[model samples]
Target: MVVQTESFVMLSIVLFVLGAMGVLLRRNAIMVFMSIELMLNAANLALVAFARYWGNETGQLFVFFVITVAAAEVAVGLALIVAIFRSKRSINIDELHEMKG
Candidate 1:
């Protein structure tokens, strides 16, 4: 039997939920950031799937832009994390309170 778009959407939803849970439950800053990225990727997958199903290019174009932004975010974020690690010697969110100032 052929798979349906609904099934794909459901899978994406599950992935998004898992990512959200991971972000909420993890204390490590890197793991939390990775979870957020996973959530973004899940949304991108759903958007592309929906675009294909509806015969529209806009959603796919939006996903491309989102991916570009995500890449930039990852680059900048990693740089910041590296700086923080050098100063703090740890990547735990709890130890990052000094970043507020």
Candidate 2:
């Protein structure tokens, strides 16, 4: 059975909203990072759905680039989080804001 693009888009929207809420409501750095990744995945899902619906490769190609950038972001972001956790012994966002040099 062929899946409709609207369904995919709807699911993507739900995921994006959940990610946004997570980002806004979570105080843990790792949780916030995960939420950002979730948002990215949601966007990628929509892009792939649109690409499939339109019979074009452009959206899919864009999604590929986005995924690549997201990977790099994950690497760098995790490294920073680790470093901060090592120095501060905590990963709380509110505490992190107090780290102004």
In order, what lDDT does every prediction score? Answer: 0.89, 0.95
Model 1 steric clash pairs: none
TM-score of each: 0.89, 0.92
Which residue ranges in model 2 land beyond 4 Å of their true spot?
Answer: 99-101
Q: What is the lDDT of residue 61 in candidate 1?
A: 97
Residue-wise C-alpha lDDT for candidate 1, range 1-101, written one tens digit per residue = 27777887888899999999999999998898999999998998899888888998998998999999999999999998899999888989887675564
In candidate 2, list every pair of residues with a backbone clash: none
lDDT of 1 at 6: 82
Worst 10 residues of 1 by lDDT: 92-101
Q: Quote the lDDT for 45 in model 1.
A: 85
| Per-residue lDDT of candidate 2, residues 10-92 (tens digit) | 99999999999999999999999999999999999999999999999999999999999999999999999999999999999
